[model samples]
Target: MVLSAKTKQSGVTSTTNMDKPNNSKRPLSHATDSTRTSESCDVLVLSNKMMTNLTSEFLTEQTTQPDVISKVLLERNKLKDLPFELVDFINLEVINLSYNCFHQFPSVICEMLSLREIIMVGCEIEALPSNFDQLSGLETIILDLNHLRKIGDTLCTLNKLTTLSLGMNYFSVFYSTLPDQITKLNLDNNHLAVFPDCILALANLRQLNLSFNRIKELPVEIDGLTELEELLIVKNRLHALPSTICNLV
Candidate 1:
């Protein structure tokens, strides 16, 4: 009942607007993507640089030394696709490409095996690549505000995933099974009329957000989520209550 609850992704990789990268900067060309922080630290912030496409050449040109970076923040860019040369980042882990104009998941990201987190909010992406399962090391995925409807079990393979944010999209139905290890689930502002049955199976779930939907009621079997801690249910069409909700305590 904190009213501040925000929904995360359901069965796919998603991000949130709140978790957006720092995109506060004057519009610059892709050539000047490097920032003062990247020159000194392992975290590279290439946000608000007006980049339509990120290239390995620019990565190399960012500094005289082109080696493994830990985190790369490329928020509020116009990136649609990444170069294949991106695979050279063997040790790269976290990448933030939020608030872009991509209509599809950048396939080059699939090869980064060491990656753990991928945050890309406010994009036009509709589908994930076929090789998305290759990233077994992924632990978090934030992909809010896009055209995602069905996940096709792409995220189910990410056994390491714990947090997924996919709110503010076109999800009227979600049949894909999410990872049982997932601790937080967000499905706000979608077209869901009936509560997703798949969610009831997550015994380890701690936080759940089903706000801003068309759901009318909850099932009495809701008590199955014994580990749930925070539940957000705002702006729904519910007229009745499920007695099992009391068991969440």
Candidate 2:
């Protein structure tokens, strides 16, 4: 990997060179900034053909745009209307497809057993597939800024999910089933007025973002999120948080 550095008052600003090779059959890798800077920042160029040759490839914790990548970003790229047959060729372990314009998630994704994480933020998706529970190895699923109103029980079956993002959606239905393995959850920008008790089941949860919602009060049992580390409740209608949260932050 080649490193490019620039002068900054704080220190050296470095960007990794991840340009994709010019190959039509290659799986391009797109790069996303953890800081959420610009839309045209960088792409994590990859060789789709080369990656297909490998048995196991892990690409955890990477962000992507909507149009180019299938796993990350807002608008589906019109140029990448791959056939459903290509689903079997995918071997990605982590996929961050947040902030996109997909109306619905492809049903073929259920066949991808190798996918460990799926991040589809700001998409127009409404509901997850019924077979989503088949993803036994899935550990993280971030689906923010969507038009979804309810989560399927199939999703709650992902017992290995550690992080979940359901922010900016239409949660009209009451959540009764929550994954037990979630450690970080983002429920900001929703239509919630009260903190649901169902979330307390996540014994390992460390961070909870509930900002920009219609919540007016919190549950007293919120301290049940024992492993809580950071709780972001900004821009909400909440009058106060439980005193127990003070020690977690």
Candidate 3:
């Protein structure tokens, strides 16, 4: 697989080329786009060696317009200008913009129609779009080490989400509802004291970590999670874990 960047006056567009493996002549179906009229490459796949050298060069040349690319991994880049306008391209499935300097909420992110996993950890984001719940297809959201104060009510609409991490954030608000689809949860090193009983609604959760928080007691209904496999509350101010917790394991 080879990465090629095409630059226009607006920015850069990337194309991934695959050298034919001698044995297999089958065509690879990168994502399809209905509105794209001209010849275009919608997906790019690169090996570890190619990704290490060209990821930054590919992104730096982007044209600041809607991209046809479906998946972008730009972690640990010195990225300052996150093209919010590019979010209108709903074809993106996975984006890794971690370790950048993005501040405040990025509203355009909510418009990505196919985005499934977003890893924007340590971006310094303080809030999210108000209609953030509209991202119905999102499955994994990693916002660890940001400056978020509260999770918007729209969070309950991400029914496909399986893993969530808000560790090291400044979450001051209380959560009254959590999506039932969540299977892995991490709230380590936050400022939460207690959450509403509605937390027990996640009956399918398998791993839950609330270590390093200021929580004092467990909500009695928490034992209702019969599928829970690991529950870690190592550094919280718990007097005693509910006997129900022992029953789950």
Candidate 4:
């Protein structure tokens, strides 16, 4: 559901299995481009496109229906930055910017207040933008395979965040910044060498993954996750399981 504009430089269309974005030059409802105006787009798949950026020509028309787009998928591109013009999509909720070479978190996303999910896997982002927690509607964030080592207290402020994935990063020590609101967490393939004591405080965490790390033991305090339905700790250096492991049902 992205603009099927001829990229001024690459001559690419930047879309996968959806309708072309509406513009003054195109019909309101083409046979394929059915998402227009009141028929808000639910998903926009722009993955695997070689696009480096979304230019003004592609963004010039989204303002005509600021509430039309709900999701934008921009994975597997060579993008390093995003156009600020994206702020016009007032109703946008989900965004996937995976497999790009982004060195920094795109700050423009912090302004999209309606966002509920953000997926930015395999990027180079080492830090989140300031005031990131202000997007109070966010529920899920996947930042796997990035350069992140620490995220401040910003994440815990989003009360709606329930799912968090932070695998394959540069983390050596776990950060206690995790919120109790999280029900699912993934920290596989990092450099962690200890069972992070902070996780024992998450009374609401239902599933935890700590596979492929250097951890040598699980603590008896892990029974604090009384609600845990699934726990994975394969491929670690543990000599034995904690005695309280049987407490989790």
Instruction: Score each candidate by Cα lDDT.
Output: 0.72, 0.56, 0.63, 0.72
Off by over 4 Å in 4: 1-40, 61-64
Which whole-number lDDT from 0 to 100 does residue 109 have in model 1? 92
Worst 10 residues of 4 by lDDT: 26-35
Q: Candidate 3 on 79-136: residue-level lDDT in tens?
A: 5455554555557887666666668655667777788877777879888777888888
Question: What does candidate 1 score on TM?
Answer: 0.83
lDDT of 2 by residue, 1-249 (tens): 211222222243332344422321111112223213234433333322222221112333233231233332222332122224435335545554443335778665677676776766655788887788888888777777788888756667777777777877898534758788787677767888777667777888766766566666667777777776555555556544457544443
Query: Candidate 2 — which residues are off by over 4 angstroms?
Result: 1-76, 79-82, 96-101, 243-249
Q: Give candidate 3 misplaced runs (Cα > 4 Å).
A: 1-68
TM-score, candidate 3, is 0.71
lDDT of 4 by residue, 1-249 (tens): 121222223434343234432431212111122112233355556678898887766765433555677878778899898888778778998888888878999888999999988888888889887689889998888888899887767787788988888888888888657678888788877889998877888889876777677887788887788887666665667666666766664
Model 4, TM vs. native: 0.81
Compare the candidates by TM-score and give the number of the best one.
1
- Model 3 has an lDDT value of 0.63
Reference-based TM-score of each model: 0.83, 0.66, 0.71, 0.81
Question: In order, how many clashes per candidate?
Answer: 9, 27, 4, 0
lDDT of 1 by residue, 71-190 (tens): 777888888887887677677788888788878888889988999888777887898887899999998777777888888788888999887777777888878788899887777767
Q: What is the lDDT of residue 231 in candidate 3?
A: 60
Candidate 4 C-alpha error for residue 242, in Å:
0.9
**Local distance difference test, candidate 4:** 0.72
Looking at model 1, the pairs that clash are 8-166, 8-186, 9-165, 9-166, 14-142, 14-143, 15-142, 15-143, 15-144
Kindly report the root-mean-square deviation of model 1 from the true structure over all alpha carbons: 8.4
